[model samples]
Target: MKSMMMLMLLLFLMPVQAGTPISEYENLLITEVVVTPTDAEMIEIHNKGGVTLDLTDVYLTDATFSNGNVYYYQVVSGAGGGGDFNDFFARFPNGASIAPGAYQTISINGSDNFFSTYGVNPTYELFEDGAGADTVDDMVEATPGSIDDDPGGTVAGVSALSGGEVAVLFYWDGNSDLVQDIDYVVWGDKREAVDKTGISIDGPDADAITSVYLDDTVIASQAVINASSHAGGNSWQRGNLNEGNETGSNGNGVNGDDETSEDLNNTFFEGLPTPNAAAGAPPAPNLIINEVDAVSSGGEFVEIYGSANTSADNLSLVFYDGDTDQVYQVIDLTGSSTDSNGFLLVGNTGLSPDVTIADDSLQDGADAVALYNIDASAFIVGDPVTVNDIMDALVYDSGQADDAGLLTLINPGQSQIDEGSNGNAANESMARCPNASGGSLNTSTYQAVDPTPGVLNSLCPLGDYYATADDTNATTLRNTLHEIIDDHIVFPYSAGTTDTWDVLSFADEDPNDSNLVWMIYKNNSYTWKGGGQQAYNREHTWPQSYGFSSGSLGDDNAARTDAHHLMLSDVTYNGNRGNLYFDDCNAGCTELTTDVNNGVGGGSGTYPGNSNWFDGDSFEVWNFRKGDIARAMFYMDLRYAGDVSGEVDLQLTDNPGDIQTGQPFMGLLSVLIDWHNGDPVDSIEQIRNERVYSYQGNRNPFIDHPEWVECIFVQGGACTTVGDDLIFASDFD
Candidate 1:
């Protein structure tokens, strides 16, 4: 959210072209400063003008500090301590000029080490001050390439590094006289001035006071480096130069232009200090904990890829399990690395032997994995890791929230890491859609895909079904509904056994009732699917006899085998349901399935179903199970709604010829739709929806979105008014 606001501000302030006229003061913009220990006083300047400007008469002066003493030092080149500004900056002989789009430094000799770090040669190095200074007012200047003795004075040097208000001024004198100022940048709040609250640079004035600064726009946009909030590593500059982190049209400007003010946002740098170097220098990492295969049966693995060509060396990928609440594992990546785009960090090489791997730490369902800057070997269970240590953290799960219920992040320090959340499910990984150029990890940026460890994230299978909706009525969404499901793997059915037993445990795992299995179809209660004596079988909620192929044991028998619908029903009740359509089995006919008298009990006679509305040809479902039954039936009907030559071959209609060798159809459409709306999705149905999605690589669209029923089956208003045109919003609205 903060990044968004920054982007808006950047756009609002970005100049259309780099042709704006730059005042002399705007040309030499102050970007960085260090004033502490009395011995180390420095400032970095950026040249933002169109062409090089001579600095012959430029002066680095003070606007009276707490002592109220006016002092000035000439800005020149080379090492110096006396003459003009050997204590500040030296002048560049006679015809000297700063090149356009350049940087210059104004510092004392004590800060040479800091300037050396970024390889920025200073404009002038202050001459040695020997031991200490004892004065309230004094001034020093030197000629090019010379360090002269400090001229003793009663006045002292600039104030110490404590948080006080100070403004660095850069003004030019047209002639030899030091009065008529051409341009100046009055940075920091000058405490010695009359008004100490607001900025004096943009104040109302004429040629009096310190009013000859730059244009109103420059005054309004000068990025004032806040001394109070300044930290050791933090520098004031553009966070992302490519993304327009600078101001003004000139390439030299790092923080301010005529478009924005040196407000709090612009003042100081965004990261660690780089003294003489350009502000906002060094871009953030574009590396992402790209993908993870936590639920992969093939073994767990995590992949890290860089959208940009960043070295992968010295980085450590850390894993933290919420169950343990500590750093469970740490993979210390070695070598002069970093160009690790296709790097796969897998544990137990046997898991993905054919692929490239560096290291491990297994991740299962509902887990958290964090990538850190260095090794976390000392971190163990219960020990809280420094949030700063974690570069990027991701939670691989389908649950709406993390185990701890904390929202995940999608960037790093001030920052650039990612943590995926919501709409992300099992059997697939969370990957950035357009690779790495993203800022958030919500439903849009992260996509679920089949585990593609060690490969370009986008190379994985498309998410035919990772995302599911609940209250959708969009025709466009309904039209592409089938696209959300992928059929890479499917489980076939048996008389009593199938992947159902294993998958169902997770789908409806209940320990107390004979192992973690939701058995003996009823509503919300678990008994047993039975054993030796007599047992219930996998009941096709949408029975096979009514037009679905009874599993040939191979794929393609979705109606008979899809786990989303198959449930545990009494064996005797199973034989009784046969190929009956769902309706009010009231008239004189054989009844089956839905009540005790439906012939389901430990000891049962061949007493035909009396209460379970079954009229020989059609069956009636219990009220509690209506919505569940309706969803499964719709799932089977639409899942296999593959184009039949040109039209949908399978549909839920009243008449669907004799069992086999006949077109597929179911009946009591009005009743089913009523049942669907009346019951809504319950706790059990929702559990089943999640479980089926976890196992079958797809979910019952109706279960996820019960509203799809009317949108799909009504004719004109019921959503199935018998024509395609009537199925969409445009038809009626």
Candidate 2:
């Protein structure tokens, strides 16, 4: 029994015929190489095959010779009398393996030095002594009597792996004397024959060569190679080579190398070193034309977004005119880099730009601005649109015809952005909302917002905020909008901490003068008096008596204190327009005057002029703020559904009897719709919307999408046309 067991053990240990050898040359790819900062050198290998790879008996070396025939050898300890070349070459330990689609980084210098440089430990270290106390695995050393073991002369291993040296990975069975070269890479200079003495050899007069061999057969020769000596924290990385070779194609020939020297040079790029990680494509210029204010004024500027602290050298911002679809201006962006927050502003003089151009250099619109990865000199005036090197582009027009030729360079399927669609292009600048999102070259990501040139962009809500709202049915859309804006963070009407007063103070503060408040009723600015009746007061645009009375629920009433419908008003004007339904009153109404600032409202006397007019039963907000008041009414109608305990179901109608009775109803709905359509959202309204949202955590959907008012109230509502006038269902009831 003992003799049978011994024979079985011996049979199990004996080498069997190699069944279908793994084609490791194509499966194990040399991905990255860092050859400088001697102590931090590294080589990264990737397992592109589908199955895990057993690395046992695998060898890595930097020595190959071909005088009479190609002969590959391993480094040994005490070679050339006393040189310690053991750390230069590595042999895989018994259980070493690499999983599919994973990376294995071998620290050529030392594990400690690699960790110090890359901030992460390497997978395996060639020198056991270099690992120190770290948990990094160590590779086996070459045999002591290997081919390079000379007794007398001085021999050296690839300690620095300096430029012009080749690194090769192979598999060898010492017992059977079978060798198969797996991968090879050489850099810094073209291949040239060298004498054996150059590598401190003593026996054969063979010449050292730069080539790959498989089972002693020459497969590839490095006649032409990458001549770049990637030093100073840069590395040569493999890219696109494994794209079609993932399933293992051994080069273009049957018995040739897996990749040629030309393939290596074309695919690899000098990129930041990535140890123990997949080396992707080298960093291309990742800049986007983030913001543009081509207002023809002095403050015109363009903002760019990119990786923080990265070089912006050799980049240019080009402007194209719509008429000819040609280059109009080019701003050189050399010698500038992104700030710590990844923003770079190129503006006219006096705007503190990272790069400065002449004032008013940017055209207003029917134009385009593009960022390129080349120099400004590459572009000339009147040159036709060039899309080859465009990194990002924004084709825009101020309500003009689309520039079809220029739009082709932008993101696929996106149209030319209309900067004037918001109706206040001069006071606003086109910016990428949510700040640098929505990918590159996409004009759909931009919105006309209050200009914020050198800082983070405004957080404008996306147009899809009411994505689930049912537009086909008016009641469904109204209900969906209510759900979206409900459950808000309510603040007390007056409190020691944040309150309605605090919200209105910031929401209504003059855009130009922060110390003054813009009165909604009077259309003028007043000293901010902290809710004092003498200076300014909070006017519930949808008066509280209609649905949400402050006397009934006090400060706990959300609808009563909601900032969306609240505005700063002159204390006396707030009384003059008390609890009246919004309507257009003419001839017999008392007119209140206005003062203009921030590009809104400064006129008087005429029937429908930019002045507030009021009668006993109705009040007409100034033309400049009609949309503001109409949107407030719309918000009230949607916000209070009376589902909650203290809430009331408010409604809008064209009936004066319903509003006069004050039974949770307000308005002449037809006039409000006309007002909303006539006065589109301006910058002041947008700023005020953002401010109110900051405190109340809710937004007026009408202000965000004024077109939805007609979608929900006019086309979708239960209405009848009587003599070309549309009246709501409540009017008949």
Candidate 3:
């Protein structure tokens, strides 16, 4: 027999087949790298991976130029974008991984200039000053196969060389003086010593500028010197190209007739004669026109940018009616194809001209740019959404079904529950909001998360126990519990033995596991703290739904004994348990079993709780087997039935789920039938029965010492006080 038992136990303990590990690469990719005219010697590294890549150790270098040692740089973990300072360069704000195949652009400007012009022969560079021109000259490969445009396609040089209009890159030299200076000349015309549109000599106070001409017609330009605009000695220029805007009737040898009256076809960045130290915090997302594909009655194809270098990612923009305060839609602009000025080139589907027109030329949508301000009271660290608001939004945006798109943005756990999945969020939340006191559901019974001992993820320790002194009411309750447990309840330790349940201490080895800890819930979070002291809130076993009136449960004749249906419970569990009757299986039946000895030998006969009265129709006594049923039924009796007149019908229950009401008790009782072969004991149950004894306190002698079998029903079967008298006095009868 022992061998068979051991074999069965071993078989039960054997491990089940393991399931496949979840792959992180299951999500869909969203943003891709967008290339356009405004690329401007810049490149974005999109997160095309399944998870956020830690870019801290990731290397970025320029290896295209003839010079092997061009430039090198590194991206710090959280320093890149979205107003966050410590992110993995490979990742973004909120730990969101750049979606698989998504682009994460790294600009070759400001602090990131090294990657722009690191390796190049005839080298690629940004020339702030040219002796022959007044404006900064951006060297380009006017002739194909030129030196300035040569990328050598090297790992250290430019990533690409322009076939018709090559480009040059620049960086702030870190000179606090704000003085602009000539950096370097990268000639790409295949000519080692070309004229290169060099800046001409400048007179005192005259700004020297370089101008490009095709058939004596200027098109693009950049500035080089700090000369007055009127006395332009040096002016900046785009590549050395001169395309006539349009040949006018008075056209001279010059395609357009007048040099100063030429059409501005090309683009240029005019360096202010004096740098404006106070540049309005570059417009939230300094967008620029990157490209313009097409423009017609149809929508336009434009791209916008949200870079990590800028503080723009923190913004939440909405499209609204220009005339009315009506809001349209919110957009995630961080990945929009845009230029440095926050304008999509035009014609991008995201920025279609038709959509723009429909929205009133972008001006209307501009009015919708209101901030989604955070409400301090509603805010939680991991999520920005409020419960009710999120629920409404989900209903509106996703229809009756769960919206995977919206869920993608919310915490996965919350999303699951919101979608009606039996995830832990709802359960956890309900379990954490119970009343602290073992009895009473009142304002004074409220408990909160403990603030001191400040363990972020762990529960409050016993020494720092807040409920003990949060208020006079809580203190009294604590005292009462101590007295009751010491006197009536027999703790394993109090019985001259070591307490088996010593897991309540924060010092427990598995402090992180809430299940292993006592006096706390499943999250390692405190069940109750002093009122308003921490994250916890007191829970009530007997809901105050019936009324808030309070009095002793046994005080049947008392006028104010209406609100006696309250007991402490975990906060989060309370929500999950919700409000319901305990009679889950059958009315008035509990799962509790009586000892065989008590049932047959008549030892200590009657069941606990005076609330259990003899009912000849069915059974002699009532007992709540399921803990939840007892709690819920108690709540209903004390709150609802006690306050208002109603049929006090018994409920049927089967242990369907964690109970918070009466009906479920009957179900639990059935479930425990197989295991019941001995005496049943529950301290709280004993107290309840004692209190309800004859609707009187301990002063009632008859209630204290009555016929043992008068009204008793043991686990084995039913018993009746009337039957017992007849059986005992059979001869007399």
Candidate 4:
């Protein structure tokens, strides 16, 4: 029969090389394999260990050996069956070896085809002679068959590998007839058949061919390690090959079969074929989409944050439209980089972007802005959104329905962030609070704020902090605010460690001069000479004499030393205004002049012309600081309730007669309310609130939300409405 003649030819063609085993045989791995586009077919092997490995006697084959017979499926050209048996397998010739951390690629379709496809020569050529200069190692091939014969159903040859195949790398020692299976990988549906059964060919008795099924007693069980099939032009590669050496095995102690599919769903990702190189995706860029301004106005832009002065070469900013769920534009950032402050921008003209696009390029809502570590040319304008090589993304909508495809790019459990949720004006932009605080693909940390391109994002107002506070009713809102800000970390008035003075030094520090403290009453800057006999002393805006005088409640009285009401003041002015209720003075009051600068208080002589006034029984603050003084008094009334031991229940009243020493009350509340409305919060007051919050761990609600004032004070617990009407009523009352 023709099968017998072809078997004889296979024996004659294979050169008898002495099968010598090397100790480093276990260090070899079949890293990658490409079966489609036959001319580009190749197999990549890796040397994972530290030393170089001699590959002589190493066999790469698709044939399965069973009981002294080789079972293989032959393919000649494009068709199956009746080809040279040698074309189905290959062996590493003498002097063939791989260095540590190096890769050796075997060109299954000859060196010319591999070079034309990948623009690089392969390490070895299997189907052609290696007399050419491009071949790194000459591969030994099997002999041609004399007669074309069909040997049942067997699939062989790397080019013929189109799913349902297994590639094995092994070492053979001829002296003791020992065979060591190094690596094995089975793809597609052939795993079950390969593990269960094989065909048997009786040696010289040609007609004695039969199928051999495995039984428990005679079973030659081989470990099965499944891999992905070649369907979408993707090759199966060892997972996490770029991270470190792979330790997963084919349930055997062999090196080549180290990759298992236990976490295939999570770890597997699609990518282009990489011949003779590291596999898997490259490292993602350390960057994020920090801010976005996508209003109807043509000034829309996106900000990126990353390490300072790092190059953004090959990174791209892609915009997706909600209607089509496809990319609309790709801004190439090949020549761009983050500035010294770690910020970069892509926007319309006049915004000074690092990369500029056309006006109105960004959709206002129900869209996405994604940053990817890929070239811009590779992106198609109408392609669906993909997570491949994506570094960061923001899915947003103004009032439109959420785009499910755009949402898929973000982290799980996080929904699309609405640009209009926080009631931002047309000129405002959505920014990541606290800079880059959130993890990758997360939008929970963003908030609408005044756009601050190329700089740190503004600390968003603490709206979520008051989520449990009842704002519908005035009394409930006040009580809820008290509970939210109560039990904060209390620093000592004066101690061997960090005290109230240390906090005030930073809290009341002159914005222009770090060495000076801005004195509250004098409205001027002075050098901070620490506590006793100093040029400035701590003035209690809500005087301690009325409720918590020095030692009346012992050293633990938080109300007496509270930094919210305590301010740095000139020493002489502190005594002049002692225990006086705040009220506007008429003609005969002593006029205390104020200095210019510090953004407030700079006039003289005339009654209350940006100057402090006093009439022995009452003190009036200058024009700019009236709101600051009123808010401090409001905090004291809310903070202490006498419920805790050694604490006082401070109250604010319209009658000055109720403000007696040793009593828990402060007055002329009607004048204080007028002062609060007359002088709104400024930059100085906002800075002071933030500084005090740093140490005390509580904020003055009036500084953050000025609208809450009328609700709690004038509405008498009925705070159902907000806006100009409530403020207008409070102004007249």
Best by lDDT: 2
Candidate 2's C-alpha lDDT? 0.69
lDDT tens per residue, model 3, 1-733: 9999999999999998542212222221111111122213432333323464432222222222212211111011111111111100111212222334443333322112323332211111222122343222232221122212325431222323121121111111112111111111111121111112222222223234322322322211211111112122112222112221323333221122322222221211222111101111212223221211111223322222222112223333333332333444444333323221122322324443212323223331112122222222333223322222221111111013443433332334332122111232111111011111211111121122221110111221122122222112323432332222221221111000111122112222223443332111112234322222234332333332322312212111121221112222234434443443222223443222222221221113334332222221122122422332233232232222222232232222344453333321222334323212222434433333332221211111111212211112123332222234765544455
The order by descending TM-score is: 4, 2, 1, 3
lDDT of candidates 1 onward, in order: 0.47, 0.69, 0.24, 0.69
Those runs of model 2 whose alpha carbons end farther than 4 Å from true positions after fitting are 1-458, 461-464, 715-733
lDDT of 2 by residue, 289-400 (tens): 8888887478888999864444577888889988888998888888887874467999988889998888878887789999988888899999999887788988888788
Q: Write the per-residue lDDT of candidate 1 for residues 458-526, one digit (tens) a residue.
A: 332234343443224445445456555434235424211123444454455553353435433332334
Question: How good is model 2 by TM-score?
Answer: 0.37
Judged by whole-model lDDT over C-alpha atoms, candidate 3 comes out at: 0.24
Residue 69 Cα positional deviation in candidate 2, in Å, after optimal superposition: 99
Best by TM-score: 4
lDDT digits (tens) for residues 485-540 of candidate 4: 78866755653234577678878999899889998888888987765558888888
Off by over 4 Å in 1: 1-478, 486-488, 494-498, 508-516, 519-534, 546-556, 589-611, 644-648, 656-661, 718-733
Question: TM-score for all predictions?
Answer: 0.36, 0.37, 0.17, 0.39
Worst window of 10 by summed lDDT in candidate 3:
80-89
Model 4: residue 306 alpha-carbon error in angstroms = 28
